[model samples]
Target: MPYTTAPVLPPGTLSRSPQPVLPTGDGLVLRPWRGRDVAAVHEAFQDPLMHQWHIRRSDSEAEVAGWIEGWEKEWEGERDAQWAVVDADSDRLLGRVALRSIHLVDGLAKVAYWTTAAARGQGVATRATATLTRWAFEEIGFHRLELLHAVANEPSCRVAEKAGFALEGVKRSAALHQDGWHDMHLHGRVRGD
Candidate 1:
């Protein structure tokens, strides 16, 4: 029974266009993941800090390759979009940013990101998030984007705030890490905000 308004965004909204490379205007670029980025991705997941929040690490290049493939498939499926944050001039991988858990019918998605140790303190995550958010709103026509992080993940909380996502509330025991469950902070940003 289809008793509802029209979908906020139609099918093939994102899949129609090729994934785009975005500029952060802060000396960083958000580009689609490439086969050559396996090393950087592998190294990033190996960081103890990365494992703390993401709860997974790449043990081999092969696994990272599969992960890249999955990102590509997700883009083609229009279910998610992932980008490798890199130095604009050097093109060296600095981190990653993504719009995950996309709901095209609702024009919504959950944004996520992480920065390499070397990229830390450089505002890579925040700048990349902002750039992606603007694109999702203005270019792709998403209505709302969410940012979620474990309460204990203070750095991510900061990034979300800096990227202009307003803290709406906390979800109890929302995420499960290797250590255990953690309460999660939920931040949200609509197209105008």
Candidate 2:
């Protein structure tokens, strides 16, 4: 059979033009990172859970600044979208939610998120995930979205589930974290799923 390429973006749909803010309608907002956010990023990375799952945490202001700059470049390149999850009123950085490893030709992307220690139990991650999921499916024209986390990280599992990502099973020793090889739980959601 002759090959027919699938159209990733719906007819007339365009690539995301970076937005300044995405309000989640309950006091939560997703916005692009700013230079002034370095301090909050440093503080959030101090959480033990953050260090365990994410091994590339910045230990110095310079590193975090570089990280933020990288995110900006990623946005400009249309490869990823990284947002700082913040409180609407105080504008305090609660965490981050991102769409990574975007495959525009396949209309797919992976979701990743984390919350500060103070925001952990308050459903920050869940809310951010849900909000991002909606935007990716609706605005970005992604046909499918996925979330993956270490199997040992129960909190992340909860966040994925609450955001309507169905558990898709596990990949044994799929990720190399700070503690070494780790089994990963894969969860997914498709448009209208």
Candidate 3:
């Protein structure tokens, strides 16, 4: 069976950010994930909800190290970028955000994020999502940004909506969760440029 593809942004339309930005809002700082963030990332992944919804591998120190290394490689290759969410004052990592699955040829990218359990409902994810989306569209010149969430993840859907992403639709049986085939919601925002 053939799959339908989402609309792509124009070629050579999106550009990379000239420099790393430290976006701050709502007392949170969104900046590049660093090696020092490994412990925080590991701790955040320990949350049951995080493990249930997003964790695909065992949350070991080695795994966290490898994950940080992977982000470094992506940054070096200019294929993708990730950021660690932290308290603006203390610089304590609250979570992570990333623009992954980047398609420079298509001027499109997807945003993925998660916050520590303690940080939920405090607008951390919402603010981070909005800030990152704006940076992706304006600074990076990405014309299209997409976000996907399992149908059961209501909080995630809320975050996407709050970030100005329109609900494109659902892909039936688009994801296979531990329970079974599950529907996934696709949300997107197109740059005015």
Candidate 4:
């Protein structure tokens, strides 16, 4: 049956404005992806760890550019919101952060992110996630956000906690990595959490 009440977020919520640049209030910022970032994204995908965790990898700069283009299209469609996490001082691409699988009526989305090999362990993911969460809830009027990562991904789990997501449970054999099916850890944060 259709919802009897109003959507948690209105239809035009995301599309009303251009994608925003969010500040980490530390040393990083989440900005809209640029065409120039193709090379850096390609390099990030080259890391074996990125390949092991993410099912797909950018095979070439062309593919990465296409991915960035898709991000813009998805943003307009209100299905996804993507940002390139960059260094505040240098504007170097450090990673990416995104809200995927967005559901406007439900006010829910899946949080996703990745940091470069050199940026890992520097709290880049955590900072970006936290900054994005605040924007999602405060500005976009989302009610909840969920983050899921492979069970073996300890660093991601830590980032979730640091970004204020609670460990909800595990989804057994939820994701297929290059190696095989892997259990996934599910974490979530609701408004006011």
Native-vs-model 2 lDDT? Answer: 0.87
Taking all chains together, each candidate's TM-score versus the true structure is 0.98, 0.93, 0.87, 0.98
lDDT of 1 by residue, 1-193 (tens): 7838888888999888889999988799999999999989998888899889987778899999999999977888888899999999999999999999999989999999999988998899999999999999998899999999999989899999999999999999988899999999999999887
Preferred candidate (TM-score higher): 2 or 4: 4
lDDT, model 1, position 83? 97
lDDT tens digits by residue: candidate 2, 5-91:
976864333334545578999889999889999999988887787889886777888889999988877776666779999999999
Cα lDDT tens digits for candidate 4, 94-115: 9999999999999999999999
Candidate 3 lDDT, 116-174, residue by residue in tens = 88888898988988888888787667879999999889999999998899999998988
Model with the higher lDDT, candidate 1 or 4: 4
Sort order, TM-score high to low: 4, 1, 2, 3
**Highest lDDT among the candidates is held by which one?**
4
- Number of clashes found in candidate 3: 0
Give the Å shift of residue 99 in candidate 2.
Answer: 0.1
Ranking by lDDT, best first?
A: 4, 1, 2, 3
The true-versus-predicted C-alpha distance at residue 150 of model 1, in Å, is 0.6
Off by over 4 Å in 2: 1-3, 10-16
lDDT of prediction 4 = 0.94
